[model samples]
Target: MTSQTEIRVLEISPPESLDSPEAELFHGGVDVEFAIAKQERGYTDLCPSAEEVLVSLRSQKYYKKIRLAAVAGLAGAPRREDVLGWASIDLPRHDNLHLAEVHVAVRPECRGRGVGTALYSAAEELARDAGRTTILAWSDHRDAPSTRGDDDSGLEAEAILRPPTGIGGVPPDDAPTRFAVRNGFQLEQVGRHSVLPAPIDSEHNSALLSAAEQRANVPETYQLVTWKNRCPDEWLEQFAKLRQKMSTDAPMAGLEIEEEDWDGARIRDEEDRTLAFGRTSYVTAALHVQSGLLAAFTAIETVARSTEFAFQGDTLVIKGHRGNKLGQLVKAVNLARVLTENPGLKRIHTWNAAGNSYMLRVNLDQGYRPEDVEGEWQKRLQESG
Candidate 1:
């Protein structure tokens, strides 16, 4: 063990200015870790492209709630040239405002040297200053990902291991998990991550579209409404309803996740956030003509810098409107739109709970494959005396 040095941690650039040396180092470190996380999980497609990373690094919207603190080497001299590591503290504004999510990453060579501890200290300080009562973190394990996407993948993985189980889960001595547990954090929940290959096979896609279309009434009882960025005012209210339903409809495996409490204003904020981040969201909704409301919806978000990666956002079908294959319908349509709009983006990544069989089935049918498993951890910051 090495002595703790005086490493300096500073908040990153103001939204208006992002061209300083420190800013670059912080963003570059985050970008590097993005790829590293994917490599660690051995996933073909589970991270933002380097280009996307830089683009987001410079975007105000992406960093709005995100507080980036970069740690510098404590050379004990005048110049601190090397960037040891960084911490990211996300303060959710509208919902879960009291919660602060954190991510602390240090250079591989810098581990066990107290760099991560310093970074977490910075993050917790930020969270506590923001009046956050609880801080949450996530740890992604390598062997936890499914080798293949099939009925047995989820079941077998759970049978084989439950993360943080202390038996076969991320060990107490593991790097990421160890860092948190050592700092008084407890395991919260785990989620299965997956990815969908882009530029879907022409033959398979056509058959899939045809299959979903056949589920809806051929007489056109349900119609499709789509948009590039913002939801149409006519459908805004109904869309909000679907979004709220999604917050609770999905399975939350023992996690303290609160409903998004969506509304038209929040919808607008989401759209604005997408624009601020220099990204585009291709959205599709199934409109129930008789009910005059949206029955189902899905979205595909793309960053300008990362033409090869697209994030598959929320996809939901209201309970009453379920079973019409709307999940498949909306997802299929949006995937097609993403492929057509951004041909270079060859992969669409998404995450789902292992128990979410219905959504998993729809995603599997749409060409998604297993990628990795992520576990959420939480630490109720004890009030400092």
Candidate 2:
């Protein structure tokens, strides 16, 4: 039997030890009564599974700042013990500019007290200590407001009443939208998620190459080569430079996130992670030569397990003085190369912003079809606070 008393917040470091119970609880699903109890005691939301919690905790970005709450002294509670109810935030990687994403889980038993308020208070302190100026929280628009019919609903209601200062990604008709609106975050932009299926086998790839070659007007002076190793050092530099230029040049909404925002270290880290996950194969590069001058270049990585492998093109690019037809030629040759090497591949996946009609046309002509759209929701975090 537990007692109904004071709530306490504890900073649990390293997060790994909490995984088992967390996973068990999450998998078993929170009892509505337990959530209600927490809500009655003032807890707001539930934390995710221990595994996810651990990952967030262990990340170099947020480890030292993760905090949790133990609801103590609730009626019929386990003697001398409390249940974990909420998590605190301090994501250093985001710096002072980015607000921490707070996650809360209420034990059904402790709902309307002051557990959530306590947790949020601690989270705010943690953020301030970390030099953060804003708080970012999410909730579903369709879901009942945090305060709903509760005694302490006013506090819950106040947390989301301010305008959001910044927002990212598309808002589905789920928790995010509701949470933002209640908390004062305005919907900035609706975005979409896109996917490209795998590429076809070598036979189909060859046909695609032949067709593209027939249609493309790539100059004879340029030669398309597929390599099994890293691209030539100069080509690598050029590739990075061109990618930077293209990203800036591409039309999109909102602030332009600079190449510095996507530094080489981050790119290399991603590459390393991809290799560790076995998602990518050889890095492919295409160099356009004009009288021995490297006029244009492009690069791609082969994804073996991808659903897109069944298609004809993946990671296509054309850079520099290369004529418009060079894009098609490079894609065609690369597709042919990938097909010959991995005879079993079937489809290929790729993506372009909605505004990128030129690239879309090239892909369509090569037999790529429009798949589902991925939505990106944007919000002003400054206003929501």
User: Residue by residue across 92-145, what tens digits does model 1's lDDT show?
Assistant: 666776778888876666677777887788788888898888888888765553
lDDT of 2 by residue, 106-196 (tens): 5545555655556666766676666555554533221222113222224433333322222122323444354344444444322222223
Score residue 320 of candidate 1 by CA lDDT: 83
TM-score of candidate 1 on Cα atoms, chains taken together:
0.82
- Candidate 1's C-alpha lDDT? 0.70
- Stretches off by above 4 angstroms in model 2 are 1-221, 261-269, 291-323
Best by TM-score: 1
- Model 1 error, position 158 (Å): 13
Candidate No. with top lDDT: 1
Going through the candidates in the order shown, the clash numbers are 0, 107
Lowest summed lDDT window (length 10), candidate 2: 142-151
- Give Cα-based local distance difference scores for all models: 0.70, 0.45
